[model samples]
Target chain A: MPLDTSTYALAHLRLDGRRWNELRRLHAQISTQAAADGSSYLEQGNTKVLCTVSGPQEQKGGRGGARDQGNEAKVDVEMNIAAFSGMDRKRRARSDKRVQEMQVTIASAFQSTLFTHLFPHSTITVTLHILSQDGSLLAACLNAATLALIDAGIPMSDYISSVTVASAPSSDQSLDEMDPLLDLNGLEEQELPFMTVGTCGRGPGGGEEKVMVLVMETKVQMARLEAMLSVGIDGCKQVRGILDGVVRSHGKRVLESKVS
Target chain B: MAPYTGIPLSPAELSYLHTSLSQHPPIRPDARSPTAFRPLIAETDILPAANGSARICFADGTEAIVGVKAEVEKTPSASSHSINSHSINGEVADEGVRGLGSGGVRDVEDDGMDVDGGEDGKQSSKGRDEWLEVAIDIPGMRDDDALPVFLSAMLTEALLADGALKDKLYINTRFHWRLYIDILLLSLPLSYPLPLLSLTTHLALLATRLPALVSEKDEDPLFNDDWEASTHLYPPTKDETARQKPPITLLVMSVGENILFDPSREELAVADAVVAISVTQSHTNTTGPDADADADADSPNPLHLIALRTIDPPSRLTAAGLPNSLNTSAGAGAGAASQSLSSVEVAVTREKDQGVSVWRPPRGGVKRAVLARMIKMVVQAGGVGEEVLGGLRGVEI
Candidate 1:
């Protein structure tokens, strides 16, 4: 119904009137839920997610599954999609295969990023609720979980900022003609190939990004994949800047209030 | 105080707590007065995705968040046919007769100020009970657990008690609004959490706004895109004094002769009885001939009681040791004298010196007079309800 990839040649504008390499609006707030050790609500355009982090506290019961190693703390990720999150009202089962796979991916990504050895025999649970979905659901959840863990005072190697990058369908089979879109929405996601990229690092444009998560579910030409990866990495850096700004401003406000 | 995780109080410490509580002016563990609530930090309109949202945190690390979202739904055609009536004058007459007897508070609950006119108002608002859907999420509890289920029911009842909220949801004869209230308890609660949850819900509801509708009459409703054009779901009164506010539930506990509001877990563990009292503002003073002239006076706003529910205090596991009052001995004379004679001697002497002894279980139920007194302390003029209402009035929404 709206503009699609074929229209990119007309004015070089993708859907929603954004050119390639332009990201959607990003907004985030931490410590929104005081009951949890750390919590955050993040919005990337129309996609919204709420995340809460609990523990590093001692694990209860004897069921130490594969996720919970004896020598290091365990990271558990749970995802819940509201029935009204999408345009249609469909209830997701608790054992949905796709959801379970995403949960594992998120858990493993954070397992390495956090210093789990510091809290042996404990568990850190990150629960995420998707309030709305447009596209880039995993990226929004990852970013929100990162902020919540930071608010929970967990030690992490670096901030893990994430975003999605899509490769625009080309008119011809030439490398020069292929364009990489920085962000994808629900409509574009259905018609284009996209990959979510996450990077952990300090400082802006530091030139070294330790990519922690890279997941691509759709098929794309080998020639187009490299450009999408690079664009995705660049988008991650920008997301890191925004996340850092939110943390700094929030910390300043907290400090000022405590001091006064 | 470490509560619910096996209270760590020994017999001596238990006795000391009992003695301190039985004093004429009970000294709470946190040094708050019997009526003073613990200080809390709260914020409203934080969640951008939801129509209205609020978060509240107590000093003891308990926190709760509430979000209210509204969606337009088509009214069920079956109910309209069943309750349809042509006697518009009859309903109007009944409403007027009731409005004159009570004040503004009842007026809101009874018929929602009767602003929508008599024709299809009752028809459109018929099946309003199912309009509000409440879903509560607490970290370690299932949705069907007693606490969550009870909480969901209580919150739904308090909001729908006066039917004012249902009146607001009426869009037209063919359509209405349904609210989805989602509450998340961030941390495990130590005391009864009804008050914390209810207060946060009230703030969230207060901040909720519905998009202004552009389409007129029974056609499909079209909302104005501009968010600034939206109107508040619970608008403040024209005079800025009183409004159609949601009822707020508060927890009150009695220990011995003392009545406490917002009791901490420690106080609740030893409470003789606990009750949740819900109240709303009654604009009784706003009426009468001298209403304008008396508006400037320093009279406190009156509150009307909506509901009073008794909650079981957390198990008295640690408080059932020895009696604090010297006159009452918990055990039989032989048992008190035989094996523990020396310890009993020491306890008796210590009780004489410090007016402290052993903790004894609350023998029976709370007196009718005490329950009445607790109600009076909460609902009376310049009472606990007024204080809470006054405090919330200053919060920016």
Candidate 2:
């Protein structure tokens, strides 16, 4: 049951004490893994992810020599979901259909963002280790990967920030009480039909924003989808604010340390 | 992980461990007895998303998590295979599904349970037969790797081969409970590899709860609104006839003159032979006629060894049998990987027919006495299964 609070809009639901529109308390750090060129550790609620970026160096041994893109650097993403990261002790094969799909999705999402053409013939490898999973696995991975890339000083058009929003009516109440909950956690995610939205080119009324990735695994009504998309977009922009602040402050700290 | 052929050892290191293990009482790195189990810490019913979930951690830093999700899929229309293809593929009438036009993943992937093979071949010819799917994920290993394929097939067989699990899953012929049991491997065991996977999955299965079937409407299994009303897979064993005990796997290693119950990476390196035996509380389990005698005997444990897999000598999980050279990066990278995974899945399904197929055979044959002792130790370990069953009572799900 949703406890009646100052924000009554979240009343009908929210088992985790988060408001309908509120994001999970996010704790992010850059350069978390010392070995990687750029690395980041991000936590959104209970979902914890570590991302490391290596290369833009020479291409490794090639098995598929036929379709190598001479211009854009190949972006290889390997996502590891730790067995102890979840409530279950489940180990997945690396070539799991979902894992492969995630790899493809993340690689393509960052492909357009990175100036791949700048480092032709070289490969940029992004590896994400999911240490804990609460909910919003894809969104958290996307967000953490973005920060890691930025930390590596990889060129990109804009900072990609992502969030997942779900229509939580069936799980909490009837469909008539359709409420689009932002940044859903593990439990809510199972009950609701959710979509992950990634946005870039975000600023305070500076210019129109761009939608980089909008993935909806479950079906949602067309009319309600519009509403969910708007809410998800707003969630992404808000996340961008936190991420941008971290990036700017990180840049300042690095410069100051260099001068010192 | 590729059954880590013992740890990477120089000739000197290998000789050292080989000589040490050969001594009486096994004077090796760990001072524990040959049969002593490493520490195992476990938690169950942790994931709210899964009907049943559990994580098991070993002292050696290796860990695994398992989640069991019970979903109701419409029984594959046994009569309309060709007709269904016409609807999905329009006019592509290829039964092999390989040449099916614009092949989506479902058209290719077995979706886990396709019991059209195995000893119970053609079981899918009638009503819903295949109701179980097991997926094991090892971090960083490619899908088609020999280790993953072998592990997945072995785990799936551990659960489904006996039909005890599937009998419990059958709500009705129209709609059977399909358990998508996903096991994620966190780390590789340094030495011994046996029960790390089996125990985690056993607990996960024990902790699994199936949604209550409110009613069957038009071949669909409608579930109750309250998840608390769900039924546990291993519910307290109030009635002996309906009971289906979780299967436990034991990794048996034979080093020199010794039959080690649990081998470390170093011990495995020097191991002469390895056998993975899956045991479960016995019932009228007539599925595998080659079942151990204890299945029919009266003992403290009604357990029986259901499946025994032999790993031939020193098949290093790291690099020995990897087909890395075959993977060529190209425009259809995802498609290529998907194709390879499907092929590996087919190969995995075929493994059921070859009873005791060796993944990679360890060379030296063990003394008959050593082999006999290993069996005795495994039978004694059945108490651990009962203790685990006791632990399942605490699983809130």
Candidate 3:
């Protein structure tokens, strides 16, 4: 039988000290490349990603090919986990399921925000190289990809940020009352039935607005799904504000350099 | 002709060519319509670090990025004899006859076009035949001289055709206001059609945006005794010139019997001949007196007008003969079998008004229809339209 929901729910919560709803600090840097069309480096707590964007170049291949004439642009995303990135060893290969999932997820997240049709028949590839993984690897990857795209000066609808939340199972407790954690690390991730939500816009509590782009639920009870989603969604809003600040400051630096 | 060495033409290729022509009465693949154009997209200022930059992405997945950077250099004396020599700043010191001399309109006519007639006229005569050098640098790629030559010629043609660098704007042509454009390509499929693949080339140009020179007054004249000395005391202020937007080229590729808007890598692999056409818009600013009087009241306003046209001569398969009809349905499958048996003659007339023709090997019965249809597809795919097709029909292939 599957592990008891109650046993894993908030099983590892350190209630006496740190609050369950608290989030880990996030940091990001932009304009990391001299040659690429755009480049950025982002780190959320322990998860880290380096992204590089190139092209709006000629469509490769023979003439009259799709990239030859129209406004449709192509996007290629590659995500690789180094052997030393995680606590456990990672094999040197692209066939891993986790890496593939990250690639698709990151690509999908950017695709929704990017005005690809404006580029018609052309391709823009976003490469994400994961240097380290703690927890919320997907969230970090998404954040890094967004920043890199902005640095590349690729136009976008808005920025995307992601957060993870764990739900404490208690039949006696109201679903809304369940403690919502933010930015789960590997240790927290291993012990809780959490969900990851990537949102665009700001967060509540006077932060940034939020628009949900992706959601991944891991080992959460169906009954507590709504409660967990709200928690994750709220946490994502908070993260978005922090990421936006980073982007703004970075932009300021770039502008200053141009001025000076 | 036997397939070029190991490059064997597939049977499917021959059959597709024949079938499309016979069924649809397709237009000749080589005949392009005046208005029909391949699609194009351009992004400017793509490289912020570069002085000027642009990227042109075509539908066929062929893309090119061009970056332009400018540097200051002392004007070389030897270049005075060059075709564009008078354009050099120090070489033409006499500004009076040349409006560059600080004289008003009347002085301009008297000196600008006549004073240096002997030297300027010689330069003007040679200008028509002069060639500008184009250099291309691709990181880690083999040096392909043909690519640079083709790209440079196309760029020069576009600049002239669009009048982007009219004589007025490009005043300092002699001092080697070299524009360096670098192109980087990320995706180019091997089976890519020539026409479409050609579109991915990116072009970026850098030139000094010199402000209009104005005369300045000199206060301290104790050391300057002569009128020429006082006049030379004050020089025009040279403001920091901002980089202008780089010119963009939109490439359109036509393939197969049909014109696929933007074919992907997979689709390009199967296509026959491809044609890549670059289109740029020319903008001309009318400021001088000569321009004002000649401007017609009833004609469309020419101020900052965009004139759209092709940049370079469209390339085609050299060995193929011109097609006889725009309609391809004259014959059927038998045409492919008989293509090897027939011999044809071809005469190339290199004029814009003269149409290009591709002659297929003669076939009997249904084969004729197939051959005709195949040729039709090629012409239509080449962006040729009804009028061009009509013209092609009038000519012997």
Candidate 4:
């Protein structure tokens, strides 16, 4: 709640004291599930997500049909939202439309990045579980998936980092002076028009320069569209920096234990 | 969604399990006795997010996690009907719901799910028994599938039979509590699932807490802010019968000729006949001018048999030697048992008084001795119910 109505500015950009460009505080870990080939748990503020990657293994016969497609092993994505994830208990069926849509979004995004030609006639499964929700559900899922894929030692073109940027209130309080809020949370998300952008690590344009991997927006005002995109891409870059740090630290730790 | 068919066994393995269970002393692969229950490891209030929660694990690789969430809802009848609570409150002592029967043996007929067959306890209006909702989710099965549906129905029926939930959850004439109990069968053993499911529901309901209603004025209900002042689902006291017991379903497995309780999945596979019986104890009030009550009071038999149900078995059994499934006995209450409860029916009811109130017995003949022993074991399990109440009392959360 802002004190001065005249200013029309938010007292703070978010519930947490994050600058317009500041991403939520994130903590990521890899290789947590021994049963799955690769797994990662990511917590951004109060939002928690666990991603497990299994496969490049034998595909069950009859399901895929005739080893038809010569290359490009199919990737299956399953997303489970625990009934207790929300404030109110809501049980979603296994075949929920929303869950299936999310799965397709993730599968298609990774289909372009993962080196599927390496493992033909096989399948890889990515399962994402939402343990808790604060906001930016889609972006958090993508971030967790990237780490899990890396942990599984899957070959990808580069880190596929994503973030959500929403139209935020400006300090000026003028209707015209709107700011883009990075990493929208459950509260801000419900009110603001936001966009989720997934970007690759390297430069934006050229061969594989098509750095923009995914862009999902639900009815946005045309005027602020460009701002949300720029802010979202910048947020993704910052996220990539954090993911790079985790993977490097994980590698160093593994090497240290092996030497010891 | 991949079908989660749990632990499939081959024919050879099935035979191996059968041979082991049929042995003279019952040499279980896990070395358990005929009546030995798997050691239960449990904790309650772990899921503080829910109003109340409990998790129980067993050695047979079965795990049940239950969470009871209570929501405050306006009682539908409260607005339209000024239920004559005032009249009933004075004459009908809270504990005097001693059930409806005046002591007569009768075969419990399969009166369908809504059997009004309780003779002695206090009868709350039939509509009040509608609050509890039980759902079971085993990873591999669909929510609408047969296994989960049957398990949920059995759990809800057993819990509702005594109307204990409605008793404790009633807040005021205008308001009441609705409990949504979710039983997550995280893992199912190869055998009977009722015992684990029942125990989990029992412990979870015991750990349930409802807000304390403290009103400054008479008309509307207000709640106290202190969580410590909240009350347990079952009132804490010496007179346990003042409330209904959390009904538990026990798996009765017939191996060769021996009757076993809480058989593992392997034993369940090869057992000649399997029956999962839901049992709860009602009061056998001796204070009433009834000869049967006096006889029972004198004989040291005070526990009255409440609701009994039989679950379908996994395999077929030949029914030549089995006891009648619809053995109602006395506790089928007076309201609905008018047609079934008769003096001429006294002999059959007396026979049922040996305490098997299930709908149908297992296919193969269970000797008279074995059936009698089964009832005695069920009755004896009631004493342990007190220990469970005590255990629930110790749950910190």
Candidate that would win on lDDT: 1
lDDT of 2 by residue, A1-84 (tens): 332322334454477676689999988889754446888889899898878788877765555872466877989998987655
Query: Which whole-number lDDT from 0 to 100 does residue B379 have in model 3?
Result: 28
* Candidate 2: segments with Cα more than 4 A from true spot: A1-21, A24-75, A79-138, A144-260, B1-7, B73-129, B187-194, B216-222, B237-244, B283-301, B315-362, B381-397
Across B212-271, the per-residue lDDT of candidate 1 in tens digits comes to: 999998778999999999989988665444565777999998878888889887777677
For residue B204, give model 2's deviation from the true position in Å.
1.6
Candidate 2 TM-score over all chains jointly = 0.57
lDDT of every predicted structure (CA atoms): 0.75, 0.67, 0.46, 0.66
How many residue pairs clash in each candidate at the backbone level? 4, 34, 94, 30
**Model 3 CA deviation exceeding 4 Å by range:** A1-17, A61-70, A169-177, A203-212, B1-397
lDDT of 4 by residue, A35-149 (tens): 5688898987667787878787776545646566567778888787756456566778888997888888889889988999998877888878775677888888999999999
Report the TM-score of candidate 1, chain B only.
Answer: 0.78
CAPRI-wise, candidate 4 is incorrect
Q: Which is superior by DockQ, 1 or 3? A: 1
Candidate 4 accuracy as lDDT: 0.66
TM-score of chain A of 4: 0.90
Tell me the tens digit of each residue's lDDT in model 2 across B1-397.
4344435655445555666787887886888777667766788875655777787777766666777877666556434643553374533342223221111211211212222223332221222224677766664566677777788777766665444576577665456667777777655434444477777888788788877778865455678888779788877564432356677777778765677766676667667778776666545332345543434332223444456677764623322222222233543665466455666664554344221222222334556676556655565534433444444444443
Give the TM-score, chain B only, in order for the candidates: 0.78, 0.66, 0.41, 0.67
Q: What is the lDDT of residue B361 in candidate 3?
A: 27
